[model samples]
Target chain A: MRIVVPAGGTGGARFVRGLLAALAEAGEPADVTVVGNTGDDITLWGLRVCPDLDTVTYTLAGAIDEAKGWGRPDETFTVRDELAGYGVLPTWFGLGDRDLATHLTRTSLLASGATLSEATATIAARWGLPGLGVTLLPMSDSPVETHVLVQHPDDPAGAPPRLVHFQEYWVGLRAAPRALDVVAVGAEQARPAPGVLEAVAAADVVLLPPSNPVVSIGTVLAVPGVRAALEASAAPVVGVAPLVGGAVVRGMADRLLPALGVEVDAGAVALHYGASLLDGWLVDTSDVHAVAPVEQAGIACRAVPLLMTDVPATARIAAEALRLAEAVRA
Target chain B: MRIVVPAGGTGGARFVRGLLAALAEAGEPADVTVVGNTGDDITLWGLRVCPDLDTVTYTLAGAIDEAKGWGRPDETFTVRDELAGYGVLPTWFGLGDRDLATHLTRTSLLASGATLSEATATIAARWGLPGLGVTLLPMSDSPVETHVLVQHPDDPAGAPPRLVHFQEYWVGLRAAPRALDVVAVGAEQARPAPGVLEAVAAADVVLLPPSNPVVSIGTVLAVPGVRAALEASAAPVVGVAPLVGGAVVRGMADRLLPALGVEVDAGAVALHYGASLLDGWLVDTSDVHAVAPVEQAGIACRAVPLLMTDVPATARIAAEALRLAEAVRA
Candidate 1:
């Protein structure tokens, strides 16, 4: 079977790891293509940084820091600290010494006129992604950064919200301030990277792996042709809830969800994606009541264990999602 | 007293450290301006790598690895090793992790339209050069790379002698190939970096440190108005011999000197600079035979113990050079 997974950083990377394990245990021959969210991409120290793409690549290569769920293992902060000492700004972003190698290679390639997709391919090749039966591609070659509009801290009395990069909101500010709005700048003009639409069109199964609906998966869908391709695809489209028990398993999903006027509940998120995009939605057993309300919205719903506590436990969640996809297809 | 020094990497950095000591010990209130060689500068992984300027800065800041005579103390090679893993070409240059921060800062500044001189000043400020009563400037603002024309190994029959970057020849190939010529590309059109000529004209004394004459001091002289400024300056110009007993104290001066039809002899080098630029030349005691010949060329010459075993010893060398400058002034 051919599977297409559109993903974000930590949670999405964990889900895909589980998906791979599930496929292997079932003895199913599968090819997986991951469309990484580029909205979280930022240029720091004049080097291009794609947090989601790097997290996924490192996780799959078994080089990720298991404790943090992002960045490389045994990383050093020599470069980051040195940059800080030089008084370079955006001191909040933790750019590790080992992780800087990826940015350096990517930036050099892009500077040499390679597209983001081409540069990503070159980096993924170093991790032997092809040998793992995985192809990782950014959502779009064109730059599309997610910016969050938040109320100015100093002027709480109805001042126009100031825009901050998604990373600045999430990593820098720790998602403290309420997000007034999230904008995927350049999404209207960005074309789906080469092989993205084809992967969606040719897949036997399309998975949205518990990524944030408002930013991660949502940003991917914002690309001009992406949502249209998913709507037109004949394959069963399945989504796992990033939220379980009315809270995000990881990341700032709960803080960001309210900005879209959507409840931080699983059923509300499925409705936000809607029946047009999702044939099947998997919510955690803790949010079992979400199943009925989600099904009422014309999208098939199933309640299962959604927590990615470990690979084995997460594999069960993946199996349940795949089972729901089969039922939706029938 | 105001002092101006033209210098390269390693040996030159060591000399400047001693010069500072010499001034301090003599109770001389001096403003030292170091005109650093920029010919060795290269863009590696799309980041500007300024070896000479960094060596001077790191050495003076006491952050230099004493053993290696260059790079930062306790430097990590994670970035360099990682870049090599990605199969990025030109792996011979060892860009350490801590050192990379300097390059990243410089590259970012230059990309943002800051001149090389301005970027160097910003970096120097971080190293507290101003606090040390030292000012470091690059030879020119315009990009000038030294390219060495060497007999291509594959085409030994001489296919017009291929040109390789100075770093490729010096660092990558270890300067093993015979150099046919050394060209400071862009020197003809290059103007001296701002403040270079002013520093030279205003100096009470100018000393050429024992750096590679062909590529280091020679390249600095190649900048359009620099040689003219040195000749027109009222200050007596003194130089320490990079060669002692017909051997280079450090670096590949022996391998590169033949290209300019100059012998690896201290006297020959002084004659190459000629009487117009050199008012006094300091040769090692072992090269005492060179003294008469250099003096016959109409440049005052002296023999001294030139081995810079440590800071105190190098301070003595600096003291001798200053004494020679005073004699020439009389």
Candidate 2:
């Protein structure tokens, strides 16, 4: 099976790990292509940082810090602390010493005229991604960063909103302030990275893992030609709900989803994606009532245990999504 | 007193610490400006690493690793070890975690359009150099790296010599290979950084600390207008010999000096600078015989105990250099 997954950071990484386990257990031979979101990419201390791509790569390589759900195991913060000592700003983002090596390598490659896609391939290869039957590509080679518009803290009343990089909102501000809107700054001008469109078009199945719909999957779809390719793909497109029991399993989806006026409900999220793009949707058993509402919108829907507490439990969820794809094909 | 000193790493930094201490003890209020060599600068992992400038800054700030003669007081190699694990080349250069912070700050500043001089001032301020009555400036704002020509290890018999960055030769190869020649790649066209020439011309006394003459002090002089300024200055130009007992006190000067066809003797080095640029020279008492030859070359020469074994001993040597400068002025 040729599978393509559009991923974000921690949550998407976990979901993909489960999907890999599901395929391996069933004795299925597969080629998985991951189209990672570049909307959260930020240049820190003159180094290009691709948070989502690194998370996916580290998780797959079994080098990730399982407790934090991101970064390398046994990471040190000596560099971060030293940077703070130098009075460099935005010290809130945790850049581990081990994780910094990836940024350094990628940044060095980019400095030498390599495109983002090329640099990502080089870094992913270091983590042995190809050996695991996975190919990871950025959503686009051109820069596209997510910026969040939030009410200015100092001028809360009758003041124009201020724009902050998504990382500042997510990591620095902890997403506390109300988000007025989110914008993918360069997405409109960005073409899909080489092989990204073809991956979606040629896949036996396209999966939308449990990632932030607004900044993760939505940002990937925002790249020109990407949404068109997915819409035109012959394969079934299935999505696993990022929410369980009307609450996000991880990340600040609840804080950001409402910025687009989407309710904090599994059914609302599925409906927001709508039937034209999604052939099937999977919600948690606790939100089984969402199944009926989603299916009524011309999309196949299923409810299963979606906690992802462990690999086994998450693999079961992935298997159910694949089964729903088969049903949609029928 | 207004003083100017041209410096490199380790040895020069140690000499400067003693100068500062000597000035303090004598109740002499002096504005000491250090022109640091930039020929040793290299871009590793896409970050600018200024070994000489950092060494002087860290030593003056009392944050230097005393045991190693450079870098921070307490440093970690997490970043270095991790970079090696990623199979990055040139891992021989030691980039401590705390030291990497300085490079990151500098690289970020330079990327944002700050010149090397401006960046040095900003970094020096953080280390409290200004508070201690010291001003640090790069020899040039423009990039001028020293490349050593050495016989290629693999093709020792016939292939034309290959050029390696000075760091690769000194740190990576331990300067074991015979150096054919040294070139300051961009020095001929480079202009002195702001205040460098002025510091030389306006100084009450000019001191050349015991830095590597070939790559450090010599490279600074190679900058188009710098040598002219030092020669034209009214202040006496005095140098402390890097050699003691006919050998380098530290570093690979012994390996590199012969490449210029100059003998390892203190008198030979003073004559290499010639009487036009240097008004006085200080050699170790063990090489007291060098004084007669150096003086015969129309330069004032002194034989002092030049071993900078500790702050007090180094301070006495610095005091002797200052006394020689005064005598030359008379």
The CAPRI-style docking tier of model 1 reads medium
| Pairs in clash, predicted candidate 2 | none
Docking class of 2: medium
lDDT measured at residue B242 in model 2 versus the true structure, 0 to 100: 92
Tell how far residue B227 is off in model 2, in angstroms: 2.3
Model 2 lDDT per residue over B1-330, tens place: 889999999988999999999999999975899999999999888889999999999999999999999999878888878788667545788798889889999988898889999889989999999999999999999999999999867675888999999988888888989999999999988999999988888999999999999999999889999888999999999999999999987887888889999999899999999899999999999999999999999999999899999999999999999999999999
- lDDT over C-alpha atoms for residue B123 of model 2: 94
Question: Which segments of model 2 are wrong by more than 4 Å?
Answer: A154-157
Q: State in Å the error of residue B46, model 1.
A: 0.8
The window of 10 residues in a row where model 2 chain B has the poorest summed lDDT is B82-91
